[model samples]
Target: MRTNKNPSEPRFLFLITKPSLQSTLLLQALKKRFYNEVTLKHCDVIDSSTIEDGDLLLFDMMSLEEQTSRQWCQDLQNCQKKFKTLLFNIPPHYHHRDIVEWPMISGIFHTETGEENLIEGIRTVCRGEKFFPKSINDYLTQQLNLSHPQWNETVDLTHREKQILSKLRQGASNIEIAHLLFISENTVKTHIYNLFKKLSVKNRTQAVFWANKYLR
Candidate 1:
């Protein structure tokens, strides 16, 4: 499976219960779209020996049993290195907050998700950025606020702070944020520090978490 030895290349391993015409078509499309950049695989279980950092594990939720799907997600979490996981073909009526809240989940797609959106989501997740929909994010945020009432208090964020926070939520580095905003690295750091204080969070991850709950 490690036919490509280039460490810089991105690998995609699709874990489905079984193959179908839809899966075959989707794989073909991804191959054509990504060219030689992506390596595709289908397996019954994760083989740590072949896994690499930055590899994406796409779970076909529509094909797998509920308990099995959740277990596979947990198994990914226990892997030695960091890897991105995306749940696709999720049922509209499914409500598994535990899987949604898992740290390894980079995105989720429902059965109704369009092909274009799914392709874009795969690219986004592979780039180390999360790709959850607004509805899912809003639901998580609402649940967070319900659990922690202190965050319910109104906290006004400056226009600039909000912009910086949004970038942070996208997993942008300090340098990337500075470049995108056309601001100095020092200025970005200053804004980040100020926002951290305002959000009552110490670091970028916590600040992003706070924003996910408090901000839209």
Candidate 2:
């Protein structure tokens, strides 16, 4: 596993998909915000030699069938270099929740994910964290609850944290959340960090998942 302690170094992000306008625009958007922190690259083919340890691979999920996707994931796992993988453009009703168990897959990006969420997901995965869409998380939670029922543990959070979490479940951005709560964005960030810690989640998506499963 590659450790990235230095924040100044550029993280190589490889997009594994055919060239298209949408892909180009996505790369441009990433460059605009993370130009100093990320280097964008594209490859139509997946080759071991072309990948490097610590590189982040963004796979276009729409480009592969279920079996092919599994094979590709296996190939990545067998590769000599270790890299993080993120699957994007997955539909809400996607049936491959089992894909989450794959160690190489660090995150799953839904079609409805906002730009801010997308950027945050990338950063979260780069930090050796896993990301999942709320729907998938909800599904897995349901499955786990069925297989092994246990008394629910209540987590205590501040009133403000609960308010912010409610907004987050509604897909509100930090700025929108701040506006709704009549608080500064920085204050929202502080509350968000606190909530993440309390919920034992790393990103907004996972936090929303926790809120839906317990708070709802």
Candidate 3:
């Protein structure tokens, strides 16, 4: 959840590993699109003095080596800026899974992510929301599967809940689930809330994790 002091207007600071002509053009496009709602700034490095407490930090990972990425992740963790961070251009086989565990990282962007989706992701994160692409979520599922605990088959779940979980595992949103299940959106929300309690999970992502761990 976002705790922006001024929710009406939020600032964005993008930290690129190395600036280029292409990046400059991209920033100009972004500014043109988001001129009314967002304030945008780009830097080749992290500058804590320029960052505010509630600002959103967009970290471009395209040019980072593995060791350098790890070091920067640690630095961001230790920094006192308290800014929400989003990582973009993460490699598909990225080795540093610990980056996902960083509490300050509010979202991730993959190399295959489309430009429109990237903009939407930035918008979502700026609004104090976390944005994890389906690919990233699938990667997390694979990671969880490797070290998953033994399933307690007796953990009771209703047929409907199981159905919902199945759709969730396929990355269906609540609206999509409701449409497919021939139920009201409100009912889907109700079932999701109850199912989360039954599964001892918090969000849809965790529920998907639980499903993959046990259902598969």
Give the TM-score of each candidate. Answer: 0.59, 0.55, 0.54
The TM-score of candidate 3 is 0.54
lDDT of 2 by residue, 36-105 (tens): 3343444435464666667777777776566766667555644545667788887656675455534356
Better of 1 and 3 by TM-score: 1
Estimate every model's Cα lDDT from 0 to 1: 0.68, 0.68, 0.66
Clashes of each: 0, 0, 0
For candidate 3, the clash count comes to 0
Off by over 4 Å in 2: 1-10, 36-44, 139-216
Q: Candidate 2's error at 186, in angstroms?
A: 54
Lowest lDDT 10-residue stretch of candidate 1: 1-10
